[model samples]
Target: MDMKRSLLRAGLVLAVALGAGHLMQKLADSRTHTAELATPQPKKIEKVSAGPQAAPAPSPAAPQVALAALTAETPKLPPLTLLPRLPVLAPPAAAKPAPEASVAPDCTPRLSLTATPRAMITLALNAPCAPGQRVVLRHAGLVVAERLDAKGQLSLDLPALDDAGQVSVLFSDASITTASAALPDTPLPRRFAVQWMADDSFQLRAVEAGQHYGDPDNVSTEAPVSARGGYLISLGDPTLDLPMLAQIYTWPADAKTTADPVIEAAVTEVTCGRDLLGETVQSRDGKATVTELTVAMPGCDALGDILVLNNLAGNVTLAAQN
Candidate 1:
């Protein structure tokens, strides 16, 4: 019994062992099939990873394209060579200067005089006067002498004429005669001599010793000599007539003389201011008529010797002496 039990135990043990071995073999076979199927799927997944990995690495190259796009975003600038240039022109020339003009000449007249001590009077005749007039000397409203020269000048020698009183001298044409008288007066000779005052003026007095006589018969011893002719006779033949002498007496030794009497007579006296008279009376040199009478009497003021007479228009200007 013990032996049989031992054998039985042994067999049992062998059967269990064999059954375990067979079960192990079946598990191994199932594991091998699952491994094979899993292997093929793993290989497919590997192929998908490899193909997608190639696409991802190619996307990294897109950053280089992005960098090129960033460079294109900036604005571009143009070159400076397209600017335009300005043109230059020449300047204009300067203007020329104007020329100067001319002026007219002045024909003003002048007079001068001098006196001496010996009472022998020396008279000087000056400009703008006709060369054919006579100079008559008077004292105390009495005519002392007459003088005429070839150049319308007069010179007289007076010794007995008193200088303490005033003397007057008048110039007039010698060829004149009184209209009341039919026959003309006799032509008187030239040259005369008489006494003079201390102030160089003439007074009614006798002729002096050194003086030459012009009219000896007509002379008075108490009064001054009445000489018919003197130096003024040499001027020319007179053409004026003596109607009535308008005499003006002066004060005692006033020391004033005037040539305005001549100018005033020619401008305002009688018919001298009239156009008919100026045309009728002939000028000395056949020049313009005596439309303007100018006088220059030295040592005389208040009235100048300038007389501008327009007989045609009857206009006159008697300027005051300066």
Candidate 2:
């Protein structure tokens, strides 16, 4: 019985040792499988054959992404600001023109002339602003100096020297006025004229063929208008300074008796012991002759005495009576 018990204990010890060994071996194998699952391994490459074969279709590309969908994840910005507009301007206005000034009219002197009878001319002057002025009248070779009236007017008659009458007047201010006319009358009668300066120093004495001194047919300065012979016309303004004086003797157009002319000088206070100057104009047969004359005066002692000039006036002729 003792031997059988010892053999049973040995068998049990051998069985426990075998079971522990098997358990340790199974735990080691489980740890090795977990490690292999955590780590990856590289894929292996395979070689193809050298012969030709059909190729496979390629795979499609990936689709593109949209901008809205891309920017949806970015931050947003604020709106921009704007400025206001300015106003426009216009142009300036035009300038105005200036006005013109006014002027006055001119006032100058005027003269007029007209025709008259008997181959004469009528000169009329009107100078309202120039009164009492001296004026000289001229026609052909005859000149007469006179003065304007108190009314600044003058009217006179002048013998026409030309068929187409040409007359002129000269003023003291050196202004000249002229006129013209036509004279178609018959010839004038025989005339004798004498022009002198001193008033009472000279005398023209006319004596008919058989007339005596102081007779009705005698003509002299004292008796200018004679009934039986020629008449006399005197012209002058003695009040003027250095006056011009004239005397004319006109014989009848149908006279049968020859009338002689005699010039006499009487010494006076104004013409004492001085030479007397004068001009004589004789018109006959439609023609005229002008002669300048100078006469010597006596001494102042014989102031009232008369001196006769013989050769002053030439001889006179008359038509024979039937």
Q: Which number leads on TM-score? A: 2
Q: List TM-scores for all candidates, in order.
A: 0.21, 0.57
TM-score of 2: 0.57
Model 2 collision count? 0
lDDT, candidate 1, at 39: 77
Look at candidate 1 and tell me the lDDT of residue 80: 62
Q: What are the root-mean-square deviations of the candidates from the true structure over C-alphas?
A: 25.0, 19.2
Cα error, candidate 2, residue 94 (Å): 35
List clash counts for every candidate, in order.
32, 0
- Per residue, candidate 1 scores C-alpha lDDT tens digits across 27-61 of 99999998988876544433344343434444344
lDDT of 2 by residue, 86-154 (tens): 656566666666666665433244566676755557778776666898877766556677888887788
Q: Give the runs in model 2 whose Cα sits over 4 Å from its true position.
A: 1-115, 159-165, 198-200, 213-217, 310-322
C-alpha lDDT of residue 132 in model 1: 47
